[model samples]
Target: MDAFNLAKQRYADLGVDVEKSLQTLAATPVSLQCWQGDDVGGFENAGGALTGGIAATGNYPGKARGPAELRADLDLALSLIPGSHRVNVHASYAELGGQKVDRDAYTIEHFAGWVDWAKQRGLGLDFNPTCFSHPLSADGFTLSHHDEAVRKFWIRHGIACRKIAGEMGRRLGKTVITNFWMPDGFKDTPVNRRAYRERMEQSLDEIFAVAIDQQCNRDALESKLFGVGFESCTIGSHEFYMGYTMKNKKVLCLDAGHFHPTETLADKISSVLQFLPEILLHVSRGVRWDSDHVVALDDQTRALMEEIVRGDYLSRVHIGMDFFDASINRIMAWVIGARNTQKALLLALIEPRDRLRKLEAEGDYSTRLALLEEAKSLPFGAIWDEFCRRNNTPVGVAWIPTVKDYEKKVLSARK
Candidate 1:
């Protein structure tokens, strides 16, 4: 309490309203991707290779065995993280009760239990079509496959996913963001990459021909620069999606780790928003390439959130997280990444923007730089602690013991 008092006064001196920052930060919902809990291994089948150039290294024990365990793990992770949030679910995680149903045939019945679970917890849900890690994607292509039959199969899967997402939104009274990402690229330089892009454009057109309830769901297509086997080319490149999204007026999904490590999503957010009404933002960290490491409170995340808040684009930017780290405790990874994301947003919301902007507009770069650096050294930890208390979440390391206790009681027995 004393620390918070001091921090509040310190920020108030800079014309920063700490209370409004806390409120804005609290209202921001970061969707926790389901893949993190299961290491990109959904509940569709017992075991299969990660075929989409997706890799989750490390063999940490106590991985979720099924939906029940995954849900329990998510429940525990949410309790530790402050703020209301949403869950991002992939098509592969459908609960079909041991019945074999192809991806093209999935229905809302398979995910009805998830909706019920989310309703009970007051959590919103997001959807994604798993266009990788299946036999159809074994050739490193799905929607962009050369074979007509293969393209149709994946196209059907996309259509089904959109409908299911719409139902989830209607039932939950929240708009579900159904994002599409595929591993459609070549390991080696191909004779013709344009042919595949043409095929993919046709396939996407067919899949999106039938519209779902717009009020219930929003469609987003993601792009990738390159992957392990896809070193030379990626069909759904940023340029491709940008053209398609701009033409169709659909939400473009931008994954932080999906681009060249040099390119940052922070730069693309404002530019894309000028043409599109909104965007679906996926948060992740890449060590060198698109490694999908756990997200940290680094400059990338801080700058991305800062851009959104600075532009007043929070309502237009839908934020979600993507990364799977099997190395550490799965629950701990989620807690760390989610909490860091929220903390970054808090930093952004509490920024002394009015003063900084005034200085920038007047070309007072010297004072602007000084204030920016000084803002960093402010008592942010105290403000974060106070925000955690306001949300009734455990403040600081107090939640660490709870994770340890859960690991011992629940995770240790999973083996």
Candidate 2:
């Protein structure tokens, strides 16, 4: 069957009303990180500091665009995909010399402006504060004890940004989701690294406390009925603060690709869901060595993964694509990545829980594998076609020409 029919049949079998399903689907917050081009040559060229080789090769088609152009490109690309409403802007101001410099003011203004622009388009913003700009963070944010100053600096920065973010949310009626990805762990002295982690949690407690106070104030305003709520979703390489905070204020954002190779993704999802049922997700794919490959979702794996994600806690789920591509046309990469990830999520949502449960109860690896194989067999193109048919909406498609194609086109035009 086509995707729309499949979705309908699955929903019927699962006893989910189609109208309610569509409403839930429509309400789902889909976002993408704006810093993908930070390390690559792009519109916001920081004197080539963030450009990793694409610009050097002279193949950077998007290097000349500014922040306005980048935002426009994102707007156009997102309009092509279905169910994409949120865009995460990476507001790492450490490039401006931390809190001690005047650059922090400029960075905050830049982000506030972007947040306002996105609000006009009815999109939400997810903020990742400055964490990856210095060698002091080579160990990780919230995980480095040796650099007490760096930790303290981040705490201050977090508090300041929380205020700015809270103000922006109040003005725009959107929640500012702050994501914390601490690169705090040890490669050699794993035992000694425990102290570093402890300090990290302490720092996080302070940050989370501040975020809660700011959000409570924002959530209390009656005249400003924007329905926005602030959340500090912590993404870590390890479960350092699994059950540390109360519900709704601080939550864990599981990065599906961040787990070790030995740990099953399904098991990891189940463990986190069991402890904290309502959580956010930073979705991506990787192989043995690479952690973020930006590859197409593996059908069988994603089906089972989605089953876990759609349990009692699906409403609390916020989706964002975390991938790094050094290509020049970062906009096109973001567009394709977002579209593919959304398709994967839709399929997972439509799959029946009982069917999956039966396969799991069989206790045979092949039986579970077969179920996933069936889930993966659902053709994405067919599904897209069906979605358009059922919704009576024309598909918005973009033709992002590759580097070679662009080169040939540009040269031919010059002649």
Instruction: Give the best candidate by lDDT.
Output: 1
Q: What lDDT is reached at residue 120 by model 2?
A: 80
What is the per-residue lDDT of model 1 for residues 177-284, given as tens digits with 9 covering 90 to 100? 999988898888988988999999999999889889899998999998898899999999999999999999899999999887788789999999999999998899
Q: Write the per-residue lDDT of candidate 2 for residues 72-132, one digit (tens) a residue.
A: 5566556555664777655542233223442124345556557667778877776665444
Candidate 2: Cα lDDT at 293: 49
Candidate 2, position 223, lDDT: 9
Worst 10 residues of 2 by lDDT: 221-230
Off by over 4 Å in 1: none
Tell me the alpha-carbon RMSD of every candidate: 0.9, 8.1
Output the number of the TM-score-best candidate. Answer: 1
CA error at residue 173 for candidate 1, angstroms: 0.3
Q: Model-by-model lDDT, in order? A: 0.92, 0.52
Q: Which regions of candidate 2 deviate over 4 angstroms?
A: 1-23, 38-45, 48-60, 63-65, 93-108, 135-143, 185-187, 211-237, 243-249, 354-381, 388-415
TM-score of 2: 0.73
